[model samples]
Target: MLSTNPFALSDTRAPLYFSDKVALVTGGASGIGMATAELLAREGARVVIADRCRDDGEELAARLRHEYGQALFVETDVGCASSVQALVGRTLLEYGRIDCAINNAGLSETPVDLIDASGEQWERLMAVNLRGVWLSMQHQIRAMLDAGRGAIVNVSSRTGLVGKPRLAIYTASKHGVLGLTRSAAIDYAPHGIRINAVCPGLIHTPFVEQKFGDGLPELARTMNPLGRIGRPEEVAECIAWLCSDAASFVVGVSLPVDGGAVA
Candidate 1:
């Protein structure tokens, strides 16, 4: 059973303003994706949790079923065009329409020197972190177009907006994400779909811990001006709001959920 009290309720079921909407969160198995899925479910949206990790994705979906009874797990490799198309197809088949999508599935810092980075690494990162978003948006927007309304939040990194040393491929992929977000936002707003990107700073998630080290959370926390790394729930809150009607006017925005990291 999903705990009723998660220490971050935010005023009782988050106003239930999202009732009846369908949401698909890529990378919905762990970290920021998991957090966003839980929040969306709590807000009364039927959620499709898609990820490459079937074990974790199925487990999370089952838990959500036990809690909210409106979650589905779809095994997806966003890097593959066919897989992304199938994901959207399944979502529409199950839910009738998609109201929102969070393209949160991404890769960690493959910290390689720019000059030393091979074409293979570059292509690999682009396939998932960049091309994945493109393919997802392609299929997702097609469905939303038929419905005539939807929203999209692509999970970008602070590095996407700026640059981070030693992770050339990752950085380039993020930059591509922002470009995609902006272009799609402009092209889709006419169809009643809004496209935006969320740029998150260092957050306390399993990915971060594994990438940096067990003690990396402490390091990330202190590196920020706020003296603490961000939490998954914090990023989730931003996504939930962006996916909600409350942000209807928001489009083509690259909102940074960083703690003064850009400053």
Candidate 2:
């Protein structure tokens, strides 16, 4: 069991839980993904940041290597099978093994009635949010299976647990993520691999700020029991714990890091 409460952190100082391990974080250029990468690196893990944003990804990887430890940035479009495969291959080429993976690359569509949603938009969202996770897991699980041990945390959303008006496609995609987590967990548990999902509430990420603007805080207050928005670091802490030995007994759980929003 984890001795310290993950939610009570006041700073970034964490135990070296992932020392010498290699962690792969998709969508690691910004927001929740970036925070998770930073946390893992700080805890002594060599990190590979895979994302489509070349500049941001490269910058983050450089910062991590200079300030923390070994880090690499691989330009990846998770929706593309080739890109995801190269990402895994590159990680192995550089680091030799993958011990942890955070499938955090996802996108959200503008809120619109189901009837008003376009087939193109829905397909686009599914490609990255749903298929992306599945593809990443396929390769990640293969590597972990070879090593006989590993952990995975897929980033879902609060919307995955409940229906939200005007977010039909996004909700469906996230729900799919949870389903994948559970089924994969069952299949891989005996193989020494753990798979789980983190359903985050209205986290205050750059993407959220751009989407919600000045009303973001108020909207978060109205939506969650905590009456405020969550920080990226807050969500990152949950992801880190789920990937660590502290959560060895935990598997296939969709943890809600949402400030009681779902409750």
Whole-model Cα lDDT of every candidate shown, in order: 0.90, 0.94
In model 1, how many backbone clashes occur? 1
lDDT of 2 by residue, 72-159 (tens): 9999999999999999999999999999999999998899999999999899999999999999999999999999999999999999
Candidate 1 lDDT over 62-181, as tens digits, reads 988888768999999999989999999999999999999999999875677888988888888899999999999999999999999999999999999898889878988999999999
Best by lDDT: 2
TM-score of structure candidate 1: 0.93
Off by over 4 Å in 1: 1-15, 214-218
Alpha-carbon shift of residue 123 in model 1 (angstroms): 1.1
Task: Please give the distance, in angstroms, between residue 12's alpha carbon in candidate 2 and its true position after superposition.
Answer: 14
Clashing pairs in 2: none
